[model samples]
Target: MTRRPIFNRRRFLGTAALGGAALASPAYLRRAYAQSGGEVNIWTYNNFVPEDFQKQFQDETGIKVNVRLVDDQGKQFNLLAAEQPNPTVDIMTVAGHRFLQFVDSDLLAPLDTDRLTNWGNINPTFSESDWATVRGNKWGAPILSGMEVLSYNTDYVSAEEAQTWDTLFSEQYSGQTAYIIQDMMSIVMLMMGYDGNMVEYLDDPDTAARIVEEAKQFLIEKKPLVRKYYDSGAEVQQMFVNQDIVLGHSWNGPAAALITDGFPLGMAIPQEGSYGFVYTFNIANNAPNMDNAYTFIDAVLASPEIGAAMTRASGFISTYKDASQHLNDLERKATSFPDEQLANLQFFRAEANELKYGLVDPAVEAIKAA
Candidate 1:
């Protein structure tokens, strides 16, 4: 995780002082012991782990689960960075690409695959990915996967036209398209003939910068075609359903839910490719309860039962090998891609040079300014 100006020494000191006060408070001490010993604090995006699963895990293991939800992955990185020297949270749910930032900063502990009895049952694509392992040490366990694709209202845009990123710039859809602001850089990179996976070419600084600038220019040029830029999938879905927008960039999960609800929606796999990500569970380096943390992860991955439950709740596919058998036809159809489509999906992995060359944030700021 890159350290931003907002999380400086003064902010850390303030947070630490507040934490000290909380720990010293009589009311807090009265309940601290009960919440500390067998408890595992998790920092994750909202709804990734359903409340029912938390209850089930607590019942089966006798360990208390305290979840702290964040609005996005970037906040997860910021929080972890701020909680330095002594992190209060024990485990975190992070996106695959961002896992490397944690691992590189020594914020995560190497996971023991032996403790995870079901590790062998994880899909090879996830377990074998470079994102999950660094120098032969596994840092996290894969939980779920999803795609960022072009979602269009079938009433205004034909499925055929939606099959390419060019649809975003089409004259027919001018001022009628909404894009997820977070995806602007990747969308521009894909349109510029790059694979959209920055990790693949990070070692080549010249090439990386060239592509970043090209993507930035593309976004600047195409800004006039977009009606609005959204930060949430729900916002994009609402606009699509209301017929306020014909096409937009969206995640597979929410798009699937909207389609199931009878919205005139369809997800398209662009010819250039769609962005893919795997979400993982990582143990904090300063975890107060290591035993409970391992137990929690093991329970989550022990079988297809928990994986299926999570998929049903989040509308994302599980990395559990046998999870498909438990999914209904609609759930499977919404999440899984055909073999050919799967081949075209591009994963965002850890790029050691990302901080130095990444232009996504600047591009987003420029779009917002425009």
Candidate 2:
């Protein structure tokens, strides 16, 4: 599930366990009516709200769509925070890692499944995710599935070289390597076998401090080899296009986009392993057009055709189970995610393990300065 699909089976049982259980996040058993009209102001990735579907939705339901593009979830959180008690946005995309942070910041409203008709069609892996469920309320609706992996210019890197994280830090790729400053640190820690329990080990301040320090120093030492610590997939894509990075740590979406564009890009999950993530739509707490947001969410989930367009456009897998069935042979190849990835993949933790982010961010800044 190796003709392997990018995501062919259920994932996130461990993730769901982290939340105690999936009381509110699972595909709802009850059906609900979908409302229409007015407007839904959404902040999502470009191409996520596909144009053809938008046109059809408006034509059929009279709901006006206003989409504000977002590239980084951290910035998206800040934008919502600045607006405070009255955010101008209606629905915004949130990653699993940032969902708890958003909820803790009081930026999102818990979803009411009675309002989303297609909620039942979502795969349990995404629908029952830990990110959106708190207590008994669900704050996010799953839309896209993604992962963290290594991608390289196939023209430059051999498949054997792409399988190990060591290649990124090796002298062979010096002055030609890149990675995002976020979770990539933890991946490095894991790759180094520093702590099998790295994320949860932060429960003890001393232990977490030591681990963070070690990770920081390692990254600092390796800084010269990196061309950039990029902020977005587009940056990595451009770096590849510009012949700037021979190999880079990237999200599956960006690598898929590169493949679709006919780049000789090769993707690997790294033998040491990586993490998988899901992107969901979180309604702003004080959204002015709440009903329209629900209407739009349902419309998107209800159609596999639109889901197919979205997957083709964004390179992320559709959370709707039937969506990929619509992809053609070429698209299937471009968006292919090997089924064997399940062996080394784990779901990422949300709530950011505060001690980790707190230590890592400053260290990264120091690395950038040095």
Candidate 3:
């Protein structure tokens, strides 16, 4: 079995055909359950579930594992909607904010924590978040967490200067700095003196509109400094490797990948704080193999061994508290955030949807026009 890079665009797009199929038919559902000899079908992003863990689950439970990959949450939701009457996907890894949409649509099943023996091992920071629970019902298990952090080529910029978001907008790096297209809003919000959490600003229409305008103006002002607006972390890594860009924004995983590959790369948690996100494991409301789904969640997701392996493979932090014991010093530093940093981190809350369409979309348009 060949291990593929976790963030390859080619691999993610390879499963596009599956996304177009009308999935929830009675015949299709039956086949999904019966075809793999008692397999559990999981729909998630590529490489989020490591191959070794999949094999381990099958060995212990005598149940085969079939994984279907999607490129993003939008495509995952479209595919799930197609599988209406009885969704074939027994398990899924969904973004924290998207979980609220799933709950609002009645697409997810409430988790039975009683069956998840290792549930108590999860860190309170993740387990206690409103993102994991909806209206007092636990909708999913927090699996991995990460931040959208600043990364700089240490040779080009001092580590001390990279410690603030202001470095990205500095005159010295103009025409040499890069930013992810998707992160514009969060970066702009951080620049505007608002905590990067969109939830707080979204409560009132006046505040939301004001924040939107401020973010737009910030982006427009910084447009000249941005060398490129990339679509993926892998793209940013490539630019850094080629020395095409010296400073940029990146997710922890891709930045860690660069560091592991011996690049003079360093991830920074700015004084304003890093933008955070969590990935949760949720069961389909009409999962064909409910018992096997629960078993998989308990045995694999909650295991410290699995968490350690996943962190080593992907460079994203595991939510299981005991998992830290299994990590080596380097892996621990790469994956885990310090308590002070964690306290300042602003997670991508449920209001990101509104911010995306209502704030970010127009902001991007304004930048293009400028």
Best by TM-score: 2
Best by lDDT: 2
Which lDDT values do the candidates have, in the order given? 0.72, 0.75, 0.71
Residues 1-370, candidate 2, lDDT per residue (tens digit)?
0121222112322321222221223222122333356888999986687666676677667778998888888789889999989889999998866677788889999899888867987888778866558768888888888888889887778888988889998998899989986667778777767552356675676877787777778888888888889987767877877777889898888787667656678888888988888888888998988888888888778766666777777778888878778777656776665677557787777644466666766866777776
Stretches of candidate 1 off by over 4 Å are 1-37, 199-203, 352-357
List model 3 lDDT by residue over 265-342, tens digit each.
788878877678888788999999998888777766555666665565566788887877876666566665557656
Off by over 4 Å in 3: 1-36, 82-88, 336-343, 351-357, 361-370
> Which 10-residue span in candidate 2 carries the lowest summed lDDT?
1-10
lDDT of 1 by residue, 1-370 (tens): 2322221334433442332222121121111122223788998754567556676567556688999876567667778888886899888987877776777777888888888766887899898877777767988899988888888877667888977889887877888888766565776777777756676566676777778777777777888888887766557766766567879888786677565444567887788787788888889997888888987787677667667666755657889888878767766777766676677687776664355325666666776786
Model 1 alpha-carbon miss at residue 18, Å: 39
Every model's TM-score: 0.82, 0.86, 0.79
TM-score of 3: 0.79
